[model samples]
Target: MVTAKVETAGPLILVVGDVMIDRYIFGDTTRISPEAPVPVVRAGAEEIRAGGAANVAANVAALGVACRLLTICGDDGAAVELNGLMARQGVTLDCVTDKGQRTTEKIRLISGVQQIARIDHDCTVTDAARATLAARFEALLDGVGAVIFSDYAKGVLTALPELLAIAAQRGVATFVDPKPVDPARYRGAFLLKPNMAEFQALFGSCPPDRIVDRARSALDEMGLDHMLITRGAKGILLVSRDGEVVDRPTQALEVFDVTGAGDTIIAALVVGLVQGLSMATAIDQANIAASIAVSRRGTYVVTRGDLDERLYRREHFMTKLVPLAMLCDRIARARETGARVVFTNGCFDVLHAGHVRLLAEAKRQGDILIVGLNSDASVRRLKGAPRPVNALADRAEVISGLAAVDHVVVFEDDTPLALIQALRPDVLVKGGDYTPDSIVGADVVRQSGGRVMTVPLLPGRSTTATLGALGR
Candidate 1:
């Protein structure tokens, strides 16, 4: 429960657990093998990548955060490849090489978007090796912002309690990507991220309705701060100790290979937490990152540039039309981040430069801008017949596509008074034509102790003028 924020130059993260090498042989499967009852995958290209905990570290480093990976591996050629991959990703490794142990490696034969077969090589460490790893882990925890345990049922994290104690002593956050063996060993962790199957396996199966209650009970029993249940297609569900349950739905993606999606989640989530982002915002970022990871083949690492482009596409353009209930839910989450909300409403039948200027100026007044769009029926009633050149859906889409607009809520009322009363935004903005007292929702905003302001509209730029010129 460390509330004080710890700032660092690199937002340094330390990952300790199992390390492995993932090799992929890609080609076409055209014929069946006569020798065996299987399709022959004619290998065309070969690729190597860091897997397991090492993949997590690669993701963290790729996102612009300096990462240090600590793990136990054997002195084999596979170990050399894993080390080389980690080094190329700019990850500093503190590896404990054991000559007697076997280096973990997984080779997959992929043919036309399908994994034909996989071969795995893994080994466990001896008691003496585990002791040596613990010593190295203790030395690496100094000045670290966060620690991630990427357990793969390997012996690297046998001393979980001691690891948690050391991280707690230093006031550093600790997160776990838990293995299926023993859930009790993960107690006292700041956050536990277990996928759906793993979560159900650790805790007995419960009905969907009772998941939150059962999860709360487990959190209290384990003394954990939070548990993030990652559902593959359903997205992530975060349950906090204070009985807060937040659900972030997955973004639409054409998933090619689901391998390493969990690793991307852990890397992006920990970075967001250490960077002081609210849980909601951090989860949003992680969801976006995971969406990108699943679209690629094999174990892929998501970079900061990829996230930046995705976020820009999400926020800057695209009409974000949401129902009233969903809008209120989003507003509540935004409020938790101490963001000031600015509300504005208009028909915006045909977009023009004046409307763009007004919306952009309104955005400058607050952290988030919510535009209340008048429905087609409401517009026809207010402006009479032959009005509303466009439908509600089209207008809402156009308004939402702007970079300045964060949310668009279509209302059927002539005035936005009822909607304003419900939202109670921090600031109510209007175009320059209206004075503060003349605004429709000014009184409702004032009664709520909110401010009312007007942004100057661009001269000689109006949708009405454009329509009039067309008639002339």
Candidate 2:
């Protein structure tokens, strides 16, 4: 689970291709319409999001990187809406408006999580518009670290050959999320990313085991340096001109919607490359970002905070079991990163459903959860002799393994007052029938402008009751 730190001060990223507005009309469908056989949707809310190349720029900005989008749109209402959305996301828009064209827009009517119907309005770019876009691309390619061509085959990317040639002359790396157009159009690109279906459409299908060989051959024919084929469930396959092949499995735990996943991947990959990460490491980060995007319902912009939490949980689980001093240091670092700290304490002698529920509730209160486990000596002083069947190390290990618990530290005192005073967590939590005033660290947490919460314990589930039932 080794990962690289993404530098926010990396060079600027330029995105050029088709830009469109994705409009979602959400509502409820209770009965069929009297007018027709279709379900009648009682529209409730409307959402407008950036799609196509504009979405790539949004994802890059969300990752704390500088990005600029270059595309052509119609002088219509959709163009105005696109401007406001991109401005809010911190993306610089360099758009050319053509009076004869109608900006591309996809209107999707959604009932609950299911999409009922979609309406599309689009227009192709004129030859004059392509000339203006080409000039803009050349001017913007001077200081760009990388360029992403997000082609939706809407006539915006018909001049890809000239654009790729200009980027190559300027020594700027270019990546392409290509549509199923002529293979020669993508020639000389640094990297080409196409889903499994697009890959088969452009360059006929072959046996699963021979994808790498076929990808390498395509690279040679297209004069490409590298190719990344994204297989939805099968994950991503990377093939280089030098015969280097790397296969990575999908990281998504659940699939909700895959919209804008390709935009997320290209955005993450180019950002990683600009931040000085290896190609393989960049692909790994892209996979993680794509996984986060698919778990969401629509065009989700994966933020830097989201990426940090996912990476931390994936790679730093074993490091969670630390001493009190190290735990304090980690809390300080977490605070610096704008993460809230949560604190809870207990003997946790026997792990049970009640304990799990309590911990999960505590985690919901804050970003980072720190469990204060009573030391062996402290447990004996509090629960009497022959109690705490699990040792301190064993207890910490088990708690740290749980997803709800971020870090575990053993406390020697009878109560966690000393630990609380030292850490000064943003939230203090306890399980049982206790008021905020009665909690041990309530005063300390309150003085620091923090809240104290209590979660009700599950009945008939306690270590003492289980020990008694076992006749111990």
Candidate 3:
């Protein structure tokens, strides 16, 4: 398996599989019923999302990779909604139809932060439908960078071996999500990914001696090049004949629903590999992709922007500091993601002990703290005669360099009104000398329902005293 970051990365993956609808019934369970063992739920909201193969396509699309879907669905209401979801996702739906088969759907009954139960509706495809779907699959594979067979065994991949042969002869990189692993269903595949249960179930009786070896031999005999065993929470294991079996652990802090996680991993791996990433890099990318999937509430797919944002947020924050105007835009983005805002202002001339304490306290009031530094001219106007002990740009940049300050905006004219008007902070703070009611911008914030707090200036720790001590 490839170890880490590969030079080449990302590819167009064609996903062919079963399309299932994942429905969530969300509500509260208040009363214990005498009628049965289950608690009676007061239903609140019901949401439906794309699941199964459709979810994999969503994941591929979400990661900004090009993908196409080749599958079958019943001509019904679910199909209509599924098509809408696919169209919105920018994934091509070359999905064929079996007139009588019902599109698969998994209805999940959920209570606040918990799943009460899930019910599945699925059916096998008839021979005539399978032939038609196979023809459609072949026609759709012309320009695919990599091919993924997301066989949920929900009838999309009934003639598995023949499909594998077709995928192989075309030299398309393939990843097969094998289910009900009978070995016969997976023969001649390029890569086989079976969860531990499916792995053991298919080869359980063969030999207890070399469980992994036997599994590898079986895959090798079937003409498969690689095998990935997904051990939930233990992470993923990759087996390639040319290299070692590397086990990458599950990085999930908590697991909500296992639904659609595997689909995300294989889709990511296929994209990474076809895009020229090393195997290790591809799997790591897959691991990162899967880690993101399990944390989400439902079977909804994770978008590329989601993964990129998750991976790049810290870097983005460190590199994307902006001027005051642009800073408001950044702060707006932070608030949209639920970060609170704290504001404090000062000349901060000589970086006094009182300044540090005030900034730290301001930071404690909210998730992100913005320091409004008085411009040199503003400080001179406020303090009278050669006032600002430091230049405005230097002072503002120094205040921004602080660990406690999330951002810094400079204001002229002795007051922070303009900057305050821009940020509309959740909390505004000032030295204890003034009443919270009288602090500048206090009325603007209070009238807007934001809080205003007056903090005590640390005794004898003023910037003037520090400068006096420094000169001495």
The numbered model that scores best in TM-score is: 2
How far residue 467's Cα lies from its native spot in candidate 2, in Å, is: 5.5
After TM-score superposition, what is the CA distance of residue 280 in candidate 1 from its true location, in Å?
1.6
TM-score of each: 0.68, 0.80, 0.71
Q: What is the alpha-carbon lDDT of model 1 when measured against the actual structure?
A: 0.86
For model 2 the TM-score comes to 0.80
lDDT of each residue in 1-472, candidate 3, tens digit only: 2121222443567888888888889999998889888889898888888888899898888777778998889877888889998998898888777787788889899988888888998866778888998887777766667778888878778887788778777777678887765888887677888887788887665443465586667666776778888878878888776545767887665677677888888888877776667778778888877887888688847765545544542344432124575577667767875888998887888887778888888889999888887777888888877777677756766776678987666677568988888889999998887898778898888777799997888899887787678789
Stretches > 4 Å off in candidate 2: 1-9, 317-349, 356-430, 440-456, 465-471
Candidate 2 residue 103 Cα shift, in angstroms, is 2.0
The number of clashing residue pairs in model 2 is: 0
Give the runs in model 1 whose Cα sits over 4 Å from its true position: 8-10, 317-472
Write the number of the candidate with greater TM-score, choosing between 1 and 3: 3
| Tens digits of per-residue lDDT for model 2, 1-472 | 1122333555788999999999999999999999999999999999999999999999999887889999999989999999999999999999999877889999999999999999999967899999999998998876688889999988888899999999888888889999955798898899999999899988889999889889989988988888999999989899999778879999997899999999999999888888888889989999999998999888888877667666755764433566676567667766975899999999999998999999999999999999988999999999999977998767877898799998887788999999999999999999877888899989999999999999998999998888888895
Better of 1 and 2 by TM-score: 2
Q: How far is candidate 3 from the true structure (C-alpha RMSD, Å)?
A: 7.5
Error of model 2, residue 304, in angstroms: 1.6
Residue 294 C-alpha lDDT in model 3: 86
| Candidate 1 TM-score, true structure as reference | 0.68
